[model samples]
Target: MHVLVTGAARGIGAAVVAACRAKQHRVTACDIDASALAGVYAEREGVDCVALDVADAGSWDSVLAEVWARQPVDALINVAGVLRAGVTGELDPADVALQLNVNVRGVIYGTDAAARLMRGRGSGHIVNIGSTSCLFAVPGNGVYSASKHAVRGFTIAAAGDLRSHGLNVSLVCPGAVKTDMLEQQRGDDRAALTFEGKRALDASEVADVIVDHVLVKKPLETYLPGGDQWKGKLCTVLPEVFLSSVEKSREKGIRNFKSPQH
Candidate 1:
């Protein structure tokens, strides 16, 4: 299969690229950081590296066109996202825009572009990387959570809309991951709730689920830890109660964030 992955410079995106390559899939690895992307995959065989800003619709158009011209893409994984931690009332306007642009709009643009091409071919898979935050709103990361909520809704709708055209659209919502993003949350009170998980997931663990299960099963929605789905569902069904409980847990999460274990 020919796969195109955004945010391939590091974290889960990079792990997904490696996982796909291990399965012998031809991959086009893309990231906003061209130099970093090149440093990681330029020397690797069966992988083509490209620079892309997933937030720009025009960039998606041109990038997908160029890639398709060389080889039809059998799969597209939209993993590029940004998180800016702050209370909603105090968040920088620029930070809010950045999160909405890169996380929500980026996923929409990439999925729409890829679906068009895949529709014509009559078969393809599109995966969007979401977060457990999509299920429950986090205090300091409200905007990021909202963005993933949009992604979750969009991917599910897209799955139904595209299934008739032989396209599979999936949303993978993982809990806090041990990436640079997680590291950035350290020492930030606003992001304390993000550290509440017992243990952060390795990027490869999320990547493995995508490559091994999502791609094969083509499920519309998947939660990385499996247990998170129930937690998310419970939170949604009892937001008032859950919010209070979650608030109480924030201190523990903060301790986890500062602890050596994290």
Candidate 2:
């Protein structure tokens, strides 16, 4: 199988590349930062590094053309995304737009492009990387959560649209993973205060699910450590109680965060 993975230079994307390779799948690792990709896969066999800005439709064309010229992609993993954290009263429109551009629009375009190629081939897979934010709202980082919500909706619609065409679209929603993006969230007080010092699943663990379960045995959606998503759902059932507990937990966590000894 030949796979093209966006955001492949680092974090979950880079880890997925390794997971795919471990299974002996031919992979084209792509990212906007070509240098970062080169650093990892310089002259590596069976792995192609290509520069792609998933937000740009034209860039998708060029990269897909390049990919098609070499190997008709068997799976397109949409992983490129951004997050901007702030509460509603203090929202930055620019940050929101940037996150929407990369996270929401990028996945939409990537899925469309992959569909075109796969529909003609008669069979293919479209795997999207979503977040636990798709299940519940993150207090400080509402925009990021909103974008993931859009991702979940779009993926479900995509599955319906492509079902008759022999294309399988699946969504993998993972809880906060230990990645650069997670670290960045820690830098913002509004968000970090809510989720700081929380150890998360490893990127490779999520990638393994992508390779082993999603691409191999396609499920409409698989939430990593499924219990996390169930917990998220339970919050929606009783928002007042859930939020009150969350606030109490947050206050406790903050106190512990500020003074380690006591």
Candidate 3:
């Protein structure tokens, strides 16, 4: 399968590129950081690199055109995202907009481009990388969580729109993966709610499943390590009980692990 991955410079995106290449799929690795991608995959087999800012719709259009000129794209994994961990009043307006633009606008633009390029073509997939925060509102990351929540909403609606026509759209919600992004959150006291009781997820473990599902079979939604999907659903139906459970977990994690010195 031919695959296009955004946010391919590092972490989960880079891991997905490696997994796809391991499977011998023709892969286009894209990121806002072109130099970082070149440093990692310049000599790698079955991989081509492209620079992209996923927040820009035009960037998606231009790149998709270039990619289609060579061969039809079989899958697009929207992994480019940003996060800011702060108390609600402490966040800057710009930070909030960046999160919404990258997390929500990027996915919508990518989905539209995929539809334009691959719609009704009998086989194509759009997989979005979302967060477990999509399931519940974490204290330090209000707008970031809202942005992920928007991605989840868009995925379900887009899947319903495209699934009958042989195109698939899905969202993968992951717990905190050990990455630079997670590192940024560690300094924020409010984010203890997030780090509470959760082990860092491996990027490859998350990436490999993405490759498997997008190419082999497609589900409307998937949560890494299993059961997160149910957890998100329960949050809606049982809001108070759900929140109490999260608070309990946070307290337990605090008791067991001391916060690292900054």
Candidate 4:
């Protein structure tokens, strides 16, 4: 299958690109960080990289055109995103806008572009990367949660809108992945994930599952390592209890949101 993955420089996106290439599927990777993309898999068989800033609509169009010029895209994975942590009082308008623009608007643009191509082909899958934050709003990371919630909402609506035309949509929710992003958070004064909590996830593992599902069921959403399974089930069945547990966990350092020294 011909696949295009945004934010493919490293972390989940890079892992997914490698996995797809291992499967012998043609893969195109786009990211704003050209250096990071260059550091990743070289121009190997079935793998290509391009500079892409998902927040820019024109970049999306240019990359899509470039990919189509090579081969028809079968899957478009919207994996590029940004996150920030702040309560209402501490929230920086600029940070909030960055999150909203990149995390929310970026997905909207990608969704629209992917839907157009997928609908025309009458066969394709569009996967949007969501987060567990979409379920429970963290205290300091409300903006991050809001952006991810937007993703969750958009995925559901897009699923309905595209289903009649043979297009598939899935939201991939990953919990506490170990990545450069996580590393950056470690030093930030308002981080939501700590080293201990970060141990639970490996980006490559999540990427493997993504490749598996997109090739198989192409379901509405797939959570990495079954995070959505238990998380969603508990949140739905016992919201108050789950939320209370989260609060208790935070208090007990089960999930640390405090910053670590560099």
Candidate 3, residue 152: Cα displacement in angstroms equals 0.6
Residues 101-199 of candidate 3 have per-residue lDDT tens digits of 999999999998888778757779889999887887776678888999899988989988887778888888888787778777664566766677447
Question: Which stretches of candidate 1 lie above 4 Å from their native place?
Answer: none
Span of ten consecutive residues with least summed lDDT in model 4:
253-262
Q: How good is model 4 by TM-score?
A: 0.89
Q: Which digits, one per residue and each the tens of the lDDT, describe model 2 over residues 1-262?
A: 9999999999999999999999999999999999999999998888999999999998998889889988899999999988877889888889989999999999999999889888997899999999888877777778998899899999999999999999999999987677888767653556643353244678999999999989989999899778867777787677776667766655654554344221
Better of 2 and 3 by TM-score: 3
Name the lDDT value of residue 70 in candidate 4: 81
- Name the TM-score of candidate 1: 0.98
**Residue-by-residue lDDT tens digits, candidate 4, 1-262:** 8889998988889899988988888988888998888778675667888898898888888889878888989998988988766768878999999999999989999989878877886988899998777675656677988898889999999999999999888988887777776766664445533332434477888888889766578878776556555766577578787666654455433345442421
Pick by lDDT: which candidate is best?
A: 1
Which scores better on lDDT, 1 or 3? 1
In model 4, which runs have C-alpha deviations exceeding 4 angstroms?
187-189, 192-199, 227-230, 233-243, 254-262
Residue 111's lDDT in candidate 3: 91
Cα displacement (Å) at residue 6, model 2: 0.5
Choose 3 or 4, whichever is better by TM-score.
Answer: 3
Error of 2 at 160 (Å): 0.7
Instruction: List ranges where model 2 is wrong by over 4 Å.
Output: 193-198, 252-262
